[model samples]
Target: MKNKYYLLICLLLSSILGGCDARWDQVLRVKKVQPIEKIDLQGIGAEQMLPVQFPGKSALLIASKNKGVLLLDSNGDHLVSAPGRVETLAIQSLSQGSLLVAAYDELSAEVKLYKLKGGIDRKPVLQYLGGRDEISPQSALCFYQNNDRTHLFTIGDDGLGHEYLVSPGPSTWELVEIRPLYFGEQVNACAVAPFNEKLLFSQPPIGIISMNADAEKDEERKLLMQADQLGEDFGGLWIDHSGNYLWLTADARLQGYELKNLQEGSDQTIYIDSNYYPASVGVIGKNIVVLDEEVDSLLYFEYEPLNPPEHPDLQLVDEFIPRIPASAQTQPVSSAGDAADDPAIWVNRLHPEQSLILGTDKKYGLNIYGLSGQLVQQFAVGRVNNVDISEIQHPTYSAIAAASNRSTPGIDLFAIEKSGKVEYLGLQKLNMKDPYGLCLYYMDSRLSVWVSDKEGELHQLDIHLGQDARNWQLKHVSRLPVEGQVEGCVVDAQNGQLFYGEEDRGIWKLDLHRYSAGMGKPKLVAEVNTKSLVADVEGLALYLHEDSGYLVASSQGNNSYALFSRSGTEFIGNFRVDMNRELGIDASSETDGLAVTGANLGTEFPMGLLVVQDGRNRMPSGRQNFKLVSWQKIENILNLSSATAN
Candidate 1:
């Protein structure tokens, strides 16, 4: 009985530990660190402090009860001021030496915007641009940029967050729109790190929040802090200029983390050995300033230079185009944890409006959906990951669909009947360990199915059509070894050519006849480069028109698709499938398998449809599902309406 009670106690403790961040160790990298230097505020008590950037200089902006807005240099020497006691301040640098400043005052319940212009010998001028009355004092205020849009993010003590679109033209500045973040309790601290532009917030003793500050990308928040150790006083957030380090202040502890290596469980933790209840931390050129909560004076410590600044993932906004909205989405998979893997679109020739989409539930079975994205049928067969379909001139079947069945360790075939319904045919066994991605190709009287395995093996088989349905069988035709794991495969049946992704490597081209012959090897048409593809390239599909088309690959690392010309495999462009708020459909992320056809399927999909498996189904968050996009929407956005012309 004693042992049983002890086991229960151990289980309870483990469960609590699992919800918190990793264990904290003694101060690593920086040792014997404490605030040795003190900044004599000279009887000025500061309520808040932040490091602000000017045209050619930077200074610490402090809010004092006596002084309105005090700008102090590294030596704590006062530079300038915007009079009238301010509680919070948020500023972002604009083009042409104009600083868009946002200030809020608690006494008068006023929030104002000013255009700050500074010169070497002149007092920084704050040109009043706009003002608004607030109901209550906001907890924190910050600015963030997403693409060309700028927004102001603020959190209140009510645990509610407000995001407002801030438009600062040459002459005017005002909040144009508002987007709300309804976070329940304990969310107070918020800071936008400069280098990565990641929005970091702390929920006191709860956890640390890290998410994309950009309104354009996935705003999914991630926790990266050891909450149990952070105490309830963990709130203040600061980012050093020209660095990627995120400085955090909690009660008697102060630590900075290089977020890039933090996820890798690296010990880039910079800490202070001594205790200090800091109200705010100001990171300057060569010193760190912390406002002492108990005293009128400020404390300063000499710190080592922070991590150098690198480009942010938000840089994709400039490098890659914005995601077009998804037109429709299918019901989520019944099973969870990466169940919905790939999708194959079946265009009904008899009834063009009655097209169907066959998607794989790698954890359960297969799901069939109509053009409206409603599940028409579901088959609890086995784990089928990736799928494709091809028109076949068989004696019995009208069209054939095939998927890589990890359960069978081979290919699972299906028949697309004229009623726009899918029927399970049979599974062809493969000797490979884990058969992963599969695509079908049919020309003349020959129908071929290609399957790739995780252990770097590629195989091809020919299906022999029998008059009876049960007599259908597969004959192994070719087997070839690859360099690395491959998942996405596509075949251009019109040209008798094959294209496949080598996962981490790049996309390759091979002649269909050279599968087993080893006479001539596949040519690396496109190497996995930063400009075109980011690795573990998951999906590949061809949008063929006449004799030329485009090869689309799921650049899963960045949640975008890279397009290449089919004739020469030249990198055309990259695009993302963004969210459609009106239709209530979320964007695609970590896309596993996608299928596209350039054939118009009636008025609903007049330019055909592009179906992609949305690995992270969010917006109205649910299980994983497939997002259907209009092919014409992609072509127009990429300006390929004429580019795909023969």
Candidate 2:
């Protein structure tokens, strides 16, 4: 009986231990994965735009067309709604739990202020009117605090901006000062930040305006790095926590200015290319949040308060070929081969060396090529003009095309396999006047696709697809009106700068951040002298060698490319392309499309390859074919061959 009892005890112990062992096994096999939660806010229609988080809170203020403010928490939960039919609204909260909302009526030409009890959506307890009770609030309103006191400022349509103090005692306020903001021209938006006893206000499209609380006398704002002089638009502005460093986003670049001495302006201005058009700017923690509305994505960078922030100075180390080769040429296997035009190369970020070259041919439809320049696959997409590819979190790839038919007049998105197989995704009818160039960039932490109309307008689109690619949503972000006619656009991935090329004019740079401010204008970097280089400059590329300090720009008409020193605005030599004798050379004219071949040619080919359009002018047949030539041969023509010849 005792032996039997011992056996039974052992069995029970084994069962308990076994269960524990199984639990341990399960724990070991468990994988910790981050959960993605998406909160949807309804009632907010397409007209409500520019939803921004309120500083130091979980609430967000949205611009609405319904003439009211839509308030919500950070988690997309609706809090309350403030009703007003004001043309424009600006919100700012003070340390004393008081919120100020500035509303402007363009049609009525009046500026009204509403002091809310709770927040932006709370009921208004006080109101103030500006400008003859008839003048509209034509300028952007900004809020600033000095010594526990808050001030509200605005620029009028007459180019004059005024400041008022909100006395905290009751609901009473005082018109402290009314100063004229002279920007040499018209002012679009004004921003003010506290600097000791005085305030720093920026009247965009001109310079920085400074004023003190005590109006002993008024002084004209000094030109702190003139916007027009820099040849770019004022994109966005931000003041650091310590109020020592001022960040400005100019066309195709971001600049850091030291505010140590207000009288001396910024001690140093460091410029960086943002690889995309920076439309707006906000602060998230210590990172500078830049919004590129063109691509509908947000870029984050660590903010440095030093006189000159330490940044990557990408220079052209060598003009040699990259080790990677272009994807193999693809042939149309589909029946709709006669409808494609331009082919764009999309490199996989996860696999830098791996890329997909997509082309559009009228007869072949859309063709995909491998990195080796070999045809991988082909499919029909009606008639395609341009193609773009984007990588998402999922394991799938999304391809977009600007196509047209008898009924449709815009671009569409398609689902593509990593292996180059194409499937019809969805069509986006932009109803644009003339859509030509299509580019994609990540903005606001989302993938945004930009389609440019040759008439100088850009349409920002958001592409969303339901499960199984059944439906897609394409929402327009903003329609930007450009100055000169734009032909092609390239984003500087290293710095977030956007380079826009024109046909007769040179390249224009847009500080995506500043553009988002809805103020200022685009600055011209290098004006194209049609009489010298190329009559019509179109394509642009920044070739940064691993350790070198040079950048090269290719011009199609001059049949040559120019090199510039990376540090300053000095011209190096120019390299001519001898396409007159090449196979696909057309005597009529050279056109757009330029790319650098990423392959090492040890002996014969040497410094990679330069690809361009071989103007053949044949209409269905005149669509120029792309030509590839060795960069080494071109360098020899530029008079640098003997110096670096191996």
Candidate 3:
């Protein structure tokens, strides 16, 4: 009996160790790793495959170069087959339990679409839809669903992509509004982000590019990953509904990227055979399936959730930074103390040719400049920390600008003329200590100014322009808590929301116009301690559109900017403004203030502009100055659009 018990214990110990070894191999970058499952396709001669998920079941659509398009259930049982030797296969879900399949013919190099008919009980039938003769003969096609309309995307050998909106006709599918996208690379695979509606594509020799689905020009697309990090050859691309991207390389490796921030997260070797070459990849349920044409087999990998790296994967590490051409540079303003802190751009409605930039020389006062960066006017109104402009309905002046007076516990006011000139209107004393950050907002016929102290106390002061326009009435309306040193603040007047940044903490959102004498409780927008945001969140700016908006916060500790959705709790991504070689200006770091707007300021800022305070402008030595960036450049890098929230 003792010998039998010893034998049982040995068997159990061996089983436990073997299980650990299997899991351990999966985590490492080893050459010989066993897949969870594999399906033999040697006899089928499958060239490419795509995963399809319907209301009740999951299946695989295989494109056989020799045969036709074959539909197989998850169990590998053949269900349906459509005539036409295919080189590439793509499947997409349609409204009302319908399905769409796109196939590229191997011999003719023609692209055609078919609608899946029938239910789970019977073999589905493929109804002939439509064909595009204008498409490049040998190309790969993908599908994207935006709102309720479906779009077909194809990348040709010439590196140009064509997008067609699918419109269902009486008996077939119609393609309309063919939009061409010049990716400038021989892209073979493409995927659409389920969360942000961004198009992700791959360029052979390992490059990934992202663009908004509605972008009409090539300049709007940004290369997310270059060929330096990835191997020389790139394969299939897939993005799941959870915003996780899977990419296959010719070297038989699978890479996982986070779609929310466009950061690389996990990597694994697909097959052990040296000759194994991955032709395509797809996500079926929780498994990643890779098609190896060399071995004529499908290798499966279980999806693994990886923790994001300590350092953000997506960062500005290359020298190809988009330069916002500086038409001219302003002559440094001489001050007794440090000057040139923040700037606000105001467009001249009467003379659109004379738009001006209002910059605050901290030690002196406010200095106004023309679009060419030439000094137009300067006011000697004490030391001011921040400045902002707003249109005020006053009898004398139609618009006014305000700045936080750093030398005293007050805020200075100025009248702005349409021709870019400013008149000193004296300072208004506030009931706060050491006012630091300031911004002006108008809503519902009420003009208000928000001022924050160095200790994180935020006070909202209502401004009532006097009849004579020389003096202004200030009413202390509300006070909000920020805990640490708080500085930057901006208001979304359309949403009645207020956002402020705590230097050591993160950002806070509160009810702005509804705040009744500090009665409203502020909600934490993001927390630095959570690692999503770096400590000392410095500047906060809002880029509002017709349907959606973005809240950009300066993550000072990492020298990157964190972008969050204005309507949702999603952290879109983070970006850094690196050195612009073309303009000979260094990157912005330790940013104290930033401002963004969607309104066109001038020809230089036709789309909009982003002005960032460069805390350390290291050309020859460090000097503080505001760097103007075209908002369109930011929109391209981040792949943001009005439909991004959808």
Best by lDDT: 1
The lDDT values for all models are 0.74, 0.49, 0.68
**Which whole-number lDDT from 0 to 100 does residue 84 have in model 3?**
74
Candidate 3 Cα outliers beyond 4 Å, as residue runs: 1-339, 394-396, 517-519, 529-532, 642-646
Q: How accurate is candidate 2 locally (lDDT)?
A: 0.49
Ranking by lDDT: 1, 3, 2
Q: What are the per-residue Cα lDDT tens digits for candidate 1 across 607-640? A: 8788998877765456899999998888789888
TM values, all candidates: 0.66, 0.40, 0.49
For residue 333, model 1's alpha carbon misses the true position, in angstroms, by: 1.0
Q: Candidate 1: which stretches are off by over 4 Å?
A: 1-144, 148-188, 201-235, 238-278, 281-318, 394-397, 514-518, 642-646
TM-score of 2: 0.40
Cα lDDT of model 3 by residue, 1-646, tens digit: 7546544433433432222222223233233435677777757778777777666677777888766788877667788887777777677877666678888775666677888755566567777788766446445677877445577887777777677766666666666544466665667777777555677887866578778663211225777787766677675776553444555554556665566656553333343344567777777766777777766777776654445344433322222223333333444555532466777767676775477778877888888877666777988887888888787665456578889997877988888865556888888888777888888888878888899987668888888777755777788976776778877888887778888877776788887645654466778878885345788787787776566678887777666677788842578877767654344454566666776766776677676767766665443333356667776777777677643541
lDDT tens string, model 2, 33-72?
Answer: 1112223434343122223343344344443435355555
Q: Sort all candidates by TM-score, best to worst.
A: 1, 3, 2
